[model samples]
Target: MLKEETVRALEQTARQLRVEILKMLNTAKSGHTGGSLSAIDALTALYFHQMRHDPSNPKWEDRDRFVLSKGHAAPALYACLAEAGYFSRDDLKTLRRFGSHLQGHPDMNKTPGVEVCTGSLGQGLSQAVGLAIASKLAGRSARIYSLLGDGEVQEGQIWEATMAAAHFKLDNLCVILDHNGLQIDGEVEKVMNVGPLGPKFLSFNWHVLEVDGHDIQAICQALENADETEGRPTMIIARTVKGKGVPFFEHKASYHGVPPSDDELTRALEHLGHS
Candidate 1:
């Protein structure tokens, strides 16, 4: 179990990251807000506590890698990378701006800490799987991590990658599902149900774990558990709210692809204790 102080610190960091995410999205005036907000806590646990990465040496050969499979949540990854010192936090204001490194989707060539060009949806898991295979072949201890959206599971390519990850026994790969239950069109089930996810992944031979996505200690413990498991890739199904922090936005499908307005930003900051 994590110490109380450590858990509080992590929770504080996640709150701060959420603030950054909201500010960046509001600045851009165009970005995915709901999914990004939903995924930030799990990302906070990974980048701040779990993953072994060097911000100054982002290209370090032995470093663990992270892939944002649900690339629309780029703001969540961007917030973590900036906090981790991959780039200037001030650069966050440039998100989605023309020629800014913080684009609508992750681009490895453009972003300092991004591992692969993503946002194609369903392709990032395969890329992560390939990275795991390469690390294993090279005898490197680096682990590969990826995040997926519950709605994204509707894509067949995710399953293909799932099968491949298990077939290769890529024990080094861990994937987290941002099970926020709502996508752009509507509630995930109404659009296309993808529940009973645990059994499905287990059927593909993955080691499955479920947790509250917003609980910092639970997330960290699950990650630690993934590290200790062997002979199969692990799938962490993280149950989360669509818009986590702000009362008005929480679980609202309308906010999925909408950035916060100036007034909304003020309200959000107040709710987040940033005002």
Candidate 2:
């Protein structure tokens, strides 16, 4: 259990990550907005409080791995990486620029902290599973984590990887589903529903836990439960608001692939208590 002070600090970090997510997207003028904001709290809990990593030595062999399988949400990962000291906070301003390392999608070859190139969708879990397999083979205790969008689970590869994880009993692996319910087209259910998500995973043989994604304390507890489970991987179904924090953006599908305009950015900042 987290102390009250620790929970408050994590909440503040999540808010700051949201602020940076907006700042980067607004500056780039192109990037996913809704998904990034929706996933920042989990990303925050991972980088700041959960994952074992060294920003100064990103390639350190002992570091635990994180794969943002929903690679469109790279802005959130980039923001957390910057906060984790993987790079200068100033570098965030150059996101999506012609020569920037912080590209629209996560590029492992280009970005210092990214575990793999993603954004093609549905491939990130495969990559994470492979990493977990390698960790087990090497007799390393490093755990692997993947964050998937609810819509992204529509991909066949995600299920394939899920089966592999359970078959291999990758207890060192944990998957998070950002169930914000909105995708580029609008509601995920309208596009192609993947509801009854928990039951599906349970049938696939994964240890499943559902929680309000924005609740930092509950998120922390879920991570703890994942750690305690043995001989099986864990899946945390995070029920989240598509565009969290900013009122106008919340649950709006239009913001999925859109960047906040200068005017919208000002309003967003005000809503986030920055103005």
Candidate 3:
């Protein structure tokens, strides 16, 4: 249940995420813009409104954990973590630079709030399952959440982890698929065709929900519902645009891994109400 004011705050936070993402990529001159921007709303809602995390004590034993399976979206995660007070926002400019804590991919040892080093894709869910299983064995109630790219789900390992999580009745684990439809090669349908995704998760013995990935309230509700569900892992198949919010980038596959140019970044910030 999200209060109206909290909803407003989340909207503001989403805008801030977009601004930071543009600024970070603009500074780094490399990284995935489409996927990161598309996942911003979901990431913002989790870090600001839902997850049980401590900025000061990132490794707190009882805190909820998040694994960004689609680790190429590290820009969005870094922005969310910084806004949540995990680290100073100024570090954003150092992304992908040598000796910077903010690397191209998240490295848990180097970055303060990153829970896992996940850039290879299709592996975070398995790691998340292990974490959830450990929590159950330790009698801790912490939940583990993983965000996967829809394209990454094409890998065989994803379904293996999916089966493992359900077989073990890891109800404390929730996975969100960032269904932005486009991947680096092309549209997911053309790349590998992992459609019927909602039913696919249901058939795998997991509870399934679908939501607009850009809507913070809907994202929160899906997460809340996942928490209440019992006896199985939950998956939220979030439908999103490849590049969201920016006029030129939205639904465009070319921007999948391309940073916006200086002119493009300026226009994007203006579109996001930052200019």
Candidate 4:
């Protein structure tokens, strides 16, 4: 169990990151808001607690790698990266703007902390598998982590990667599915059902675990369990709400690819205690 103080601190950090994500999206006027907000808590737990990364030495050879498989949630990753000191938080305002390193999707060549280029869905897991294989071959202790959307899992390539990860016994790899229930179109079940994820991953020979995505302690505990498990990759199905912290946006599909408006931004900031 995590210390109460530590959990409180992480929760506070996540709330602050939520504020940042809303601000970034509202400024860009055209980024995914709901998914970004939905995934912030998990991303926050990983960057602030689980992952071994150096902001000043981002290229450090032994550091763990994080891939945002659902790259439309780039705002969430960008906020975490900035808070981790990979870049200036001020740069977050430049998200999705022309010539900004923080583009609509993650670019390895552009972003300081991003491990791989991920925009097209269903590809990030494969990249993470490759990185895990490389780390094993190189005898490095670096672990590879990736986040995928429930809707994004509808792609066949994800299954292929799932099979490959098990075949290779990529135990150093951990993938979190951001099961936020809704995508751009509508509810995941209504659009294209992908439930019972635990059994599916288990059949693929993955060690499956489920957790409340917004609970920092639960997330951290699951991550720690992943670290201990051997001979199979772990799939953490994190159940989350679409738009987590904002009252108007929560679970609303309309906010998926839409940024907050001027008035919405003001209300959101006030709700987040940002003033």
lDDT of each residue in 122-234, candidate 2, tens digit only: 99999999999999999988989999999999999999999999999999999999999999998999999988899999999999999999999999899989999999999
The local distance difference test score of each candidate is 0.95, 0.94, 0.93, 0.95
lDDT for model 3: 0.93
lDDT of 3 by residue, 10-60 (tens): 999999899999999999999999999999999988898889999999989
How far in Å is the alpha carbon of 1 misplaced in model 3? 3.6
Instruction: For candidate 4, give the lDDT of residue 140.
Output: 98
Off by over 4 Å in 2: none
lDDT of 1 at 271: 96
Q: What lDDT tens digits, residue by residue, belong to model 1 across residues 1-275? A: 88999999989998999899999999999999999999999999999899999999999999999999999999999999999999999999999999898889999999999999999779999999999999999999999999999989999999999999999999999999999999889989999888789999999999999999999899999999999999999999999999999899998999999999999999999999998
> What TM-score does candidate 1 get on C-alpha atoms?
0.99
What is the lDDT, from 0 to 100, of the residue 265 in candidate 1?
Answer: 95
Instruction: Give me the overall lDDT of model 1.
Output: 0.95
